[model samples]
Target chain A: MTVSIIRFGGSNCDRDAERALEHLGIDAEIVWHEDGLPEETSGIVLPGGFSYGDYLRAGAMAARSPIMADVREAAAAGTPVLGVCNGAQIGCESGLTEGAFTTNESARFQCEHVYLRVERDDTPWTAAYDEGDVIEIPIAHGEGRYEIDDERLAELEDEDRVLFRYCDENGDTGPDVNPNGSKHNIAGVLGDRETVAVLMPHPERVTLPDVGPTDGQGVLRGFEAAENGA
Target chain B: MTAYTATVTVRLKHGVLDPEAETTQQALERLGFELEDLRSADRFEIDIEAESAESAHERASEMAERLLANPTIHDYDVEVDER
Candidate 1:
């Protein structure tokens, strides 16, 4: 029962995710994209980096990789999948999740700590935190802004698929607080099921105590919860 | 088989915000140029050999649908010509 982190051609965060999971006492391994999911895989993480050098667009190439079809099938079978930063873009691009993470509103690569308000607590990803709990995570990407047709965006919101939104330290959300021009300050979202989530923030960056913040521990802990049938 | 060059142009759908284009427009304005607005598109020229120009067009259209453009925010057109 190990979490398999898919390492694409340019995935730089696979090691980070592996260490983060290990620090939580969860068994995890970095699997190359071509090798396919291991038989013992119990969870998946699409860690972040400039896959394919951001050619065409961020996550566009890797989304079409041969392995994603298997990933989709596993997710459908109730395997918990978490995508962070560039992983968020790939999730959307591959249809593992909804919407797209396009260029930032500022049109520049922005890297900083941002506050995320947990939109729900029942899902495996957010079960460790109370609803509206503010957690700090570091986001580093140029194409981190989320985009979807207005009609779909509204429908997604109505369905409560949104998992996290950028907010101030106090958990108040507004355009001013949105790090990127994500619709309604959206920073993370769920798939049709709560077990699958994609967010444009690096939970691994904050999971280690050697680092400054520890707010991201819950997101990584989600793997254990999902495996335990939470 | 006929040799063809398929031109696929992908552009952001109208009304979708494109900050890269906006930033480029701002840069042009800073350069003392006058323009009402600006938009951008990516044109991919694919060379392929197929049974006919129609087949070439079809292949390029599929490519655009699958990789060249994201339907969520992009609209694309494909044109094929004998090379």
Candidate 2:
């Protein structure tokens, strides 16, 4: 399968994401943000970076880019689309998902290794992991805190749209353990199943066992499972 | 003919803390002035020449809801003064 990785003007992780996909045995290419979406691609990934220098609100300008129209259309067509960090913010800004506003508790840039408990394993991106499994991922961003109203929060919980919850070393979601003070300790969420996934953490950064976390295999395996129809 | 002044106040909603406002308030407190509550909000004044005060108020309210405040996190009140 081929994965089209979209690269904006300021995207920093495009190569890393492409590498990860390549290592996973999938053909991947970097597609420019201004160019039209690549056809005949099985999956699309919006890599993380400071798009438009994070001006006028994070991901706000990139959300309105010319290529986002095709991205939205691909997402609506049930194609697997994954957004990482600023990409996640763009996804929310583009109305690909529900509310993902500014941080609620601590409004500051945070960078650290965070534990995340898998809330659902049915999505294409998380199918390799069992429900309730905890994994470590790196998070680095200022606007990573997810905020929503009580009603919508409850609805997300009930719908199992919450894909991952931040936790501590012991994998317990709590105030002190939460890294970015995201509402519900959310780390990732799926829009309309696994077809559209957005996560604050950078899985691509942790995919190499020699360079990054050892748990990278599991995360990549998750995507590989989806490719294999597991 | 009637003249009306419309005032719009934009501020963070309750439970949503503004770090910039907090720092400003702390600075004010350091100046040794006893203040019960130091909250910061943006104020906009627009003078409109309308047929009636009610028309001005309606127009100001619409502006407040549409642009002055982000309904997701802020609530705005508009006051019109008839002259």
Best by TM-score: 1
TM-scores for the candidates:
0.98, 0.80
Instruction: Give one digit per residue, the lDDT tens place, for model 2 in A1-230.
Output: 67888999899989988888787677889998777887877778888999999764577778888898998888887677888998888887777876664553455677878888988877777776788888888888878877767888899889889988988766788888877767888888878656788988988888766686755455555555666665
Chain A TM-score of each model, in the order shown? Answer: 0.99, 0.94
User: Please, what are the lDDT tens digits per residue for candidate 1 over residues A47-132?
Assistant: 99999998999999999998898889999999999999989999999998889999999998999999999999988888899998
Candidate 1 wrongly placed segments (more than 4 Å): none
Query: Candidate 1, which CAPRI tier?
Result: high
What is the interface root-mean-square deviation of candidate 1?
0.6
lDDT of 2 by residue, B17-65 (tens): 4555666677788998777766677788999988887889889888776
Q: How good is model 1 by TM-score?
A: 0.98
Worst 10 residues of 1 chain A by lDDT: A221-230
